[model samples]
Target: MSGEDARALPVEDARSIAGVPDGFGRFWTPYRMAYIHGEGKPRDASDAQCPFCAAPGKGDEDGLIVHRGRTCFVLMNLFPYNSGHLLVCPYRHVSDYTELTCEERVELGELTATAMRVERETAHPDGFNLGMNQGAIAGAGIAAHLHQHVVPRWGGDANFLPIIAQTKAIPELLEDARARLAAAWPAEGMEK
Candidate 1:
């Protein structure tokens, strides 16, 4: 969407443009998978049913499970950048990185490595942009739970949409990314 178009668009469009998770949208927080109820209490550091919580059930065919372990897992970005934008997150709900337990920290590190390796193998981008937007100030979409982002990047990935309009045009259907990654990646340590 163009900047002018973005400005003229609705708030829902803006959040969608920015990749914020709604009841039907995707967010990478290690907490609630997706909103269970739009009216239910917004979401807190304590909620665990977030999309990342359980083994994806019936309706989650498009929910890609890249790597799953007891404490951590890697998933394809339901919304993506290149081909293999992914998310690395602990299974538990954690708001602060400083509050992470030794176990969670270990899982976070290991899962991050696994996510990077798998994403690279799949996308083969020139570089990787790995980060965590801690809270609103840090541009966190899901502020309750902390998760690391693994975005694969090529030289020309940055487009004119944001340059001209301050809007991010992520043009691929999330289901497609999930299908491709889920087909290629075997979920590891998931049985536990």
Candidate 2:
């Protein structure tokens, strides 16, 4: 039926047809389809396809990188659980933490700590969630590389939207978050 005819129907009848007015409003996030379909996900374990490996090769802005260190780098999560979410990754194309050199391991930890501080300064989140999914079976999206997740959290952020609709509403854009965090990042040797 046409829209006009559909609107005239009773609530019960209208519900039967598509585009009927439902009490709940739609939260359309067409951009999320790219993530759902694994648009940038690597086809293999090759360093050429690994985003973490490729991100460091690109300039900071293009790569969404917040801070670049000697051994590791911090970047904005392409599909973040929240705004200002970051991932710390070693430049080496390693699939596990055990593969990290002493220098890489130290820098990764230091970068994670610095990331938390930067997020606090820039976004002032109430709390944070930090972790690393070990492999594909352990929930790592890109199992070929190892990266630590630094997700900023706030009260009420765990709302029904993610549970019911599987959608997260990020208040800020990735570029804006990257720029703000990058600008707020402490100078080298000043994180202490």
Off by over 4 Å in 1: 1-43, 47-51, 54-62, 186-192
For every candidate, C-alpha RMSD to the true structure in Å: 9.6, 4.7
Lowest summed-lDDT stretch of 10 residues in model 2? 18-27
Task: Give the number of the best model, judged by lDDT.
Answer: 2
Q: Candidate 2, which segments miss by more than 4 Å at Cα?
A: 1-18
Candidate 1 lDDT over 20-98, as tens digits, reads 6463432222222333233232277767655555534424454566656667667765535556777877767677788
Backbone clash count for every predicted candidate, in the order shown:
7, 0
Per-residue lDDT value at 96 in model 2: 88
Q: List the residue pairs that clash in candidate 1.
A: 3-165, 32-50, 32-51, 33-50, 33-51, 33-52, 34-51
Best by TM-score: 2
lDDT tens string, model 2, 1-192? 766676677767767575655776555676778877877777566747778888988999999999999989999999999999999998888888999999999999999999998888878899999999988889999878889999999998888889999998999999999999999999999977
Per-candidate Cα lDDT values, in order, are 0.64, 0.88
Residue 145 shift from truth in candidate 1, angstroms = 0.8
lDDT agreement of model 1 with the native: 0.64
